[model samples]
Target: MTETRRSEIPPTTDPRPDQQSPAASFPSADGLRFRPLAAADVEAWLELVVRIAAFEKAPWHAQRSELEAAFSDAVNPVAENSVAGVDADGGLRAFGRVVKNPGGDKAYVLGGVDPAWQRHGVGSAVLAWQEARAAERFAADGQPGARARNYVEEDNPALRALLAGAGYSVVRYFSEMLRPLVDVTAVPVPAGISIVPWTAELSEAVRLAHNEAFADHWGSEPRTAEQWAVQMTHEHLRLDLSTVAIDEAGGDVAGYQLATVDPDVEARHGRREGYTELLGVRRAWRGRGIAPAILTDAMVRFAAAGLDHAALDVDTENPSGALGLYERMGYRAQRRSMAWDKPL
Candidate 1:
């Protein structure tokens, strides 16, 4: 649920195609070289991410294909919006990327340095480059009230300190929750509602319903068709395990639950987990038990598929009382992360 969507900014008269790469102006890092990342660097980037995850005791890691797909993204193509710091031996030591939301109101700074390279100013250099890139994008769009954002694990004091020093303040907190699949219970669909298996034909409908359901959530923006297509076709997405709830009379989508299972994460952790990547109930459909019914359906399907657990992330202060609902449904908080922001 914490996943974000980026959209193409409005065309600018000054394309600045020949402008220098942000990496070219990055702060100096001893014995390191900086450059924009490319498709060829996906493998090294995945390795770097895995190393950082292990060092930080993080529960998740990225797949190589995900990194490759990031390079192809039109909104923030790696060749243009990414910077990689490499050691003398050409090993990736640090990296940064800036992804702007569809409305140009917020840009996310995503990257980290290898633990071995920490305290050597590599992180600061990468952060500086990312912030500069975010500012440049905001200026090009000429939007007011734009800001740069970053999410850090609650346990990561170093990165939190870095952001604080750079004038960013913590704005929100999110919790990663996990529910075991043992003794799962089924919840009947509320009267006049039908829960159906997710189908390719219903993808667009689900996306629209999603946008509407999240319209009032903090920091949410509508996902364009292009952005929704990318998520719908992602390698880990499991339509077979996903479900959609429809209003019996109107036949409109009332709620949905999109599922995913990352084989790489399963292999690394030695357990199968069905991730509820996105779940929501339309505003008008709230308080009808649709959310829990869909969640129970997913847990039933996940258990039937031999998955060990179900997982999801929710904003700590979700207006819909999502955290309370999850807690009541047997989910326990496994980890926490903080969102930090700085006005552009």
Candidate 2:
């Protein structure tokens, strides 16, 4: 649930997009000074994310390429949407980004602090700064009721405490699932449906079908063309390995399994992982077994590519019984991530 969203903060002279003045930098209780993250800081920022992940024993890992893409205009357009805390030693201790979800109904604040700096007000300052930016963006749109959300690992008590003390309430839970690709069995495509390799020409139809499929899911929103383009052009998107289920009768995208191969996953985990990033079946195609067929096809493709495993994230409370379906398809829970939110 630590996914990036497009922020809508307006352009400004202030280094801190949410703050009234450029000089009003975020100051920590210690000597750390917060500043807007720059293009040059991508590597160090990714290192901080990896550090926190290891400290928290998170099953999923971060990649510099992914982080770089997220900070670009295609994802988070607001330059000041992200903040970083640097120590006198020239090390980044904490970071935060206020990303506006596609539909603008909610803004997600995603960040983590060095364990050593957790109780010294670093986390609090980063969270407050993110909230300020989100509030400013919401007010600019004249939507005072917009919500700001934060997702944290269930085992991270410090983060949970900071969020609760800041007035955020638990809203949902998500599970990170992983499945070994060895001996993956493929499921047959349903009648009147065909599984095809993802193509640039069919990207729009696939994107629209995905949004329609998840329209009823919690916090779901239709993806803007800009957002959809980001995924289609993603650095690690494996177009050949991705599966698109098309309804032959109507020539519409009925279901899809968009997979990715992170260059850093093997380097960090000692094994290659093919991530099933998005798996959805349109409402008209639900209960037709299209989802599982598409998902299993992706796994089979991963195995054929010599990958060690497949990974995906799912909301545990999905009304479509998605969690049960994934488990039945051989995916097992690897870790838990939680989502919390408060109105802006």
Candidate 3:
């Protein structure tokens, strides 16, 4: 079967026993096989991840090197879990990951399946493997089952249905919203606040600022400079687009906003897309309208980049009513992702 022909792919779901059995042929003759991926599968995995994201119209831009960095980190997590699904051909076909929630013991993560392999047990298989891995880890260390969870944008019924059938239930939802650059005007920083270019010299400050801002947000975790460095290695990174708000008086990172654009992605997405990857204000700086101020700065940066819109994601259950804050800034929900979890 050709890569584009999914008609021969397995059924929408397959319940693999808790353990694998010996079979020369696939359990179901749909020409699908499930196995773990190795370092050699990096390039294939990258292609599949991009294809799957495009299929769902999700926003992401990553190169091969970025995938490698992420996979390397997977073996050693800064704060997340991951899994992969390989076919009989020994090629990667699907992937999923769960991030450790700093606020709780759960993993809130994201996943995707190759379109051509949809309903072929690729996504289901990947998730099942992830669950088993978690289970084994617990068995070895004697820790409680770390509940594995994720979210699906409400509009993605296909993904929602698949996950639900696999024993994952929606526990929370969030919207990914965007604001037109034209609707924003750059405003001067308030007293005690200043904007500066994010650079290697200021890496420590940037890390501290983000850690502080996300401290109380959902899925909070202890992030170190190493984690930040791994993220920086992402092929999609553009330091110029990432900006930080500094408190010159205290010489501390009070607030920050990181943004990036990809020409390759622009070609695929039609219009250039910019991400509000990270936006945060220190606890002490909260309620001072600092987040909005930093947002305005981000809009200014986006507009200057000749982009028309900028996007950011938020958990609907944030303690600070962050969704309301985004709405006040003119962001409307573009997509709602749902989360599903099963005992590991």
Q: Enumerate residue pairs that collide in model 2.
A: none
Model 2, span 1-344: residue lDDT tens:
11121111211121223333222246455778777777888888878887888787665555555566565553354355778788898888888776664336888787888878877888888888778878766765567687888777888787789999999999888887888887677688899999999988999888788778777778766766656765566667789999789899989888888888877778778889988778888888889998888888888888889898988888898888988988988889987877888886
Which of the two, 1 or 2, has more lDDT? 1
Which is the leading candidate under lDDT?
A: 1
**Candidate 3, 1-344: lDDT as tens digits:** 00000000111111212322212221221555544345666788778877876777665534676556554443224122455555677666666653332223554444567787787666666566556545544443345766766655576778888778877876666667777777685556878888888888888877776666666655455456556666666555667877777887988888777665666656765666677766777788777777887788777777787878877777777777778988888888876665566665
TM-score of model 2 (CA atoms): 0.84
lDDT of each: 0.80, 0.74, 0.61
What TM-score, over all chains together, does every model reach? 0.90, 0.84, 0.80
Better of 1 and 3 by lDDT: 1
Cα lDDT tens digits, model 1, 1-344, are 23322111211122234443443376579989988887788888999998998898776655554666675566676767888898899988888888775445788888889999999988888888787888877766677776889878899889899999999999988888998898777888899999999998888999899889887788776777766766666678889999999999999999999888877667677778999888889989999999999999999999888899998888898888999999999999988888899986
> Among all windows of ten consecutive residues in candidate 2, which has the lowest summed lDDT?
2-11
Candidate 1: worst 10 consecutive residues by lDDT? 5-14
Error of 1 at 283 (Å): 1.3
What TM-score, to 2 decimals, does candidate 1 have?
A: 0.90
Candidate numbers, best lDDT first, in rank order: 1, 2, 3
- With candidate 3 superimposed using the best TM-score fit, by how many Å does residue 174's alpha carbon deviate from the native? 1.5
